[model samples]
Target: MDKKIKVGIVSYRNTRPLIYGLQHTALSNDIELIEDIPARLADKLKTGEIDLGLVPVAVIPQLGEYHIIGDYCIGTEGEVASVCLFSEVPLNEITRVYLDYQSRSSVALLQWLMRESWGIFPEIIQAEDESYREEIKGTTAGLVIGDRALEQRLISTYIYDLGAEWRAITGLPFVFAAWVSTKSLPASFVQRFNEANAAGIPRIDEIVAANPFPVYDLRKYYTLNLSYQLDERKRKGLELFLSYLKKDNEQPVEA
Candidate 1:
C-alpha cells in the first residue's frame, strides 16, 4: 500500500469544495485531511505534521522549500464579502484597528492597502476575542475574515472588502490560499490533485446548497466574485504579497 499524504486544511466555508470533493473521490485513498486553522496549518507544515496544506498565501514566504503544485487557489476578482474591514470612523481618520487571528493574508493586505494606498498608519490590534462588534466599539476599525464576518453584516456600518480593495489598488485578482507541498510529490499524485480540484469547481452549486447559510447567492459569489483558477494576475498578486513579507521592516518569521 502507498503511504498516505497527510493534508491539513482550514475548516472554512471556502475550503468546503476541496475538503468534500477530495474525500469522496479517488484521491481519498492517497490523502488525509486534518482540520485546522490557517496559522496552525502553517506550523504543522513547517514541523512535518502534514505533507501538503491549503494554507494562507502570507504563510508561503515563511515556508523555506515548499512547492506550489496545483494551479487552483482560493481567489477573488472583486468584493469578497467574507473578508471585510468595518470602520466606525472614516478609514483615514481611524487611529486603531483590530485584526482577525484566523487570517494572515488579509492582515498583510490590509497593512499594504492602508500604508501605500490610504497613506494612513493606524495602530494595528491583534485581538484574541472573536467579537469584532465589541472590539470596534472601543477601536476605530475592525478587520474581520471568514464566516464570522459574513454573519456580522448588520453591525458593520462601513464595510471595506479587502479583495475589492486589492483589485482597486493593483488592478489584479487576489489569491488568498493555494495548494502548497513541502516536497515534490509524484507527477501522478499532482495530476490527481489537480483533477480533483478542477472537478470540484463545477460542483460548487451542490456544495453551496449543502451549506446552512441562507441562500448566499452562491452563483454570484462563486461565478462573479471569486476566481478559482490561478492565472497571471493572481501570480502577480502573490509575488507582490511575497515582496511585502520580505521587506526589512516587516520581520515575518522564516519557516
Candidate 2:
C-alpha cells in the first residue's frame, strides 16, 4: 500500500473554516492529519516531521524552497481580534513585552510593527509558557494568540490587534498562514485538498454552532474578521511580508 501523506494544521479556532470537511471526506484515507501550535508546525515542517502543514507565513523564507498548496489561508481583511498584544498602558508606555511562543509570524509581525509602525522599543521576552500571561501588568505587556487571545479581550485594559496594525501599515490584507509543503504535492491530491477546504467556508455557521467557542463570538469572527481567500491583494501582502523578512529591508522601508 502507498504511504499516507502527513498533513499538519494549527490547533486554533481561526483554522476551523478551511478544514471543515477534511476528516469526513475520502481524502482522509490518503492523508494523515496532525494538529499542533503554529510555531511547532513550522518546526515540524522544517525537520520533515510532517509532509505538509498549515504553517505560519514567516517560515516560508526559511524553507529555501516551499510549495504553498492551497487557494485558502488564515488572513484578515482589517481587524483580527484573536492575535493581540494586551497591556495596561499605551503603546509608548510599554517598557517590556512577552512574545507568545505559539506563532513566529505573530512574533515577527510584532517586531516589525514596533520597529516600523509603532516605533516603540521594549524589552522583548520570549514566553516559554502561559506563565507570562499573568505578568502582563503596568508597563509589561503580553502578546497572546489563538483561543487564549480571544479570552484576553474581556479583561485586558489595552489590546493592540496586530492584524489591524498591519492593515494600517499597508492597505492590503494580511495572510497569517497558508497550506505549505516542503516539496511539491501531486496535482490531484492538491485539488481534492483545496476542494475540502472550500467546502468549509460557506458552512461557517454550521461549523461554529457545532463547536461553540466559550470566549468570543465565532460567528462574527469567521464572517467579519477572518478572510479565507488568498486573492491577489493578499498575495501582494504576502510578498511584501516575505521581503521584509530579509535582512536588507530593516533599513527604513516604505511599505
Candidate 3:
C-alpha cells in the first residue's frame, strides 16, 4: 500500500468548487484530506503536519521551502464579497481597525491597502470575539473574512472588498489562496490534482445546489464574483502582493 498524500483545505464557501468531487475521485484513495480555515492550514503545512495545503498567498513568504503545484486558485477579478472590511466610518476617518484572526492573507492585504492605497495607518487589533454587530465607538472598523464576512456585509455601511480594492489600486486580479506544498510532489499526481480542480469549475451550480446555505447567493458568489483559475494576470497580482510583503520585511519561517 502507498502512503496517502495528506492534503489540507479551507472550509470557506469560496473553496467549495475547488475541491468539488475530490472525495469521489480515484485520487481519494491516495489522498488524506483535512479541512480547516486558511490560517490553520498554513500552520499545519509550516509544521509539517500536512503535506499540502490551500494556503493564503501572504503566508507563502513565511514558508521557507515550498512548491505551488496547481493551476487553480481562490481568486477574484473584482469585488470579492467574502474578504472585506466592515467599517463604521470612512477610510480616512477610521482610527482603529479590527483584524480577522482566521487568515493572514486578508490581514496583510488590508495592511497594504491602509499604508499604500489609502495612505492611512491605523492601529490594528485582533478580533478575539467574532462580533458582527457589536459596537466599538467612533471610527472603528472590523476586518472580517470567510462566511462571516458575507453576513457582515449586510449590516456594514462601509464595506471594502479587499480584492476589488487591490484591483482598483493595482489593476490586477487577486489570488487569495493556492495549492502549496513543502516538498516536491510527483508530476503525475500534481497533474491529476489540477485536473480534479478544473473539472469542478464548470459544475459550480451543481456544487452549490448540493450544499445549500441560507443568506448567500452562492451562484452569484461563485460565478459572478470570484474566479477559480490562476492565470497570468493573477500571477502578476500574486507577485505584486509578494513585493508588498517584502517591503514589510516579512520572512518565510523555516519549516
Candidate 4:
C-alpha cells in the first residue's frame, strides 16, 4: 500500500464498536477514518474518496464491482429497534410514506415490506434532510434509521421494526451494512481488519462510556439488537433482499 487507506465509516451509535477497535488498535495508524451517514459514506466510496466503507447493502446493485471485505456486518436476527417505520396509525392505514435520506437499506427494506408483507402501496417520499422528521404525522409516516431512529422511539406512537418484519416474512437474519471495497485488498490487511473489529465486540462498556447515549440502553442495544457477524444465514438473508431489489413491480412474490 503506497498510501494510508481511507475508510468511510458511518457516524451512528451502532458502528461505535467497530470504530472503537480501529481507534484503539494499530489499524488506526494504517488508515484514515472518515465518518458520515451511510448514504454519504457510500457516495464517498463511489467517488473514490475512500478505499473502503461500511456501506449499506442496498448500494451493492449500483456498484459495478464490489468486494465485501469483511467477516463482520451490521446485522440483526430479530427486532432491530433502530431501523423502523414511525406512524401514528396502523401501517396499512397510512397513505403516505417518507423514506429517510440518510439510509439506503432501511428504505429499501421498508419498500419491499410494503409491497410484500403489508400489501399496500403508499406514496413514497424521499426526505431531503432532518427537517422532514417533523412531517411524520397522520397518514404520512416515515422510515427512520440509525441513531435518529433510536431517538424517535421515545416519541413515535406506532413503531414498526424492519428487522422484526423481515424475520417474520423470511425467517432469516437481516444485514443492513458491511465493510466493502471496490478494489481487492491484500489478505494480510483483511486479517488485521477482522482482528481489529473482533477486538471491539467485547468492549461494550468502553464503547458506551466513550460516547454516551442517555436516550436508550446503549449496552443492550449493542449486545442484542445488533449482530456483527456476516455468517452463512446473514449471507443468505442479504442475497434474498438483493434478489427482491433486482425485480420490478409485480404485486409482490411469496417468500
CA lDDT for candidate 3: 0.86
For 107-152, candidate 1 gives per-residue lDDT tens digits of 8888888888988888888877676558776347888877777765
Alpha-carbon deviation at 120 in model 1, angstroms = 1.6
- Return the lDDT, model 3, position 249: 81
Q: Write the per-residue lDDT of candidate 4 for residues 1-255, one digit (tens) a residue.
A: 678999899999999888888889998899999999999998888888999999999888888899998789999999899999999999779999999999988888998899888998998899998988899989889999999999999988999999999999899999999999998999999999999999899899988898888898999999889999999999999999988887743447879
Rank by lDDT, highest first: 4, 2, 3, 1
Candidate 2 Cα errors over 4 Å, as ranges? 248-255
Once fitted onto the true fold, the runs of candidate 3 whose alpha carbons sit more than 4 angstroms away are 132-137, 250-255
* lDDT, candidate 3, 113-186, per-residue tens: 88878999888788766563375347888888889888887777898899899999899999999999999999
After superposing candidate 4 on the true structure, give the runs of residues whose Cα lies further than 4 Å from its correct spot.
249-255
Instruction: Please list the Cα RMSD from the true structure of every candidate, rounded to 1 decimal place.
Output: 2.9, 3.0, 3.2, 3.0
Q: Model 1: what TM-score? A: 0.92
> Mind giving the per-residue lDDT tens digits that candidate 2 earns over 155-206?
8899999999999989889999989999988899999999888988889889
Tell me model 2's lDDT, rounded to 2 decimals: 0.90
Candidate 1 residue-wise lDDT at 84: 87
Q: Which of candidates 2 and 3 is the stronger one according to lDDT?
A: 2
Can you give the lDDT of residue 218 in candidate 2? 96
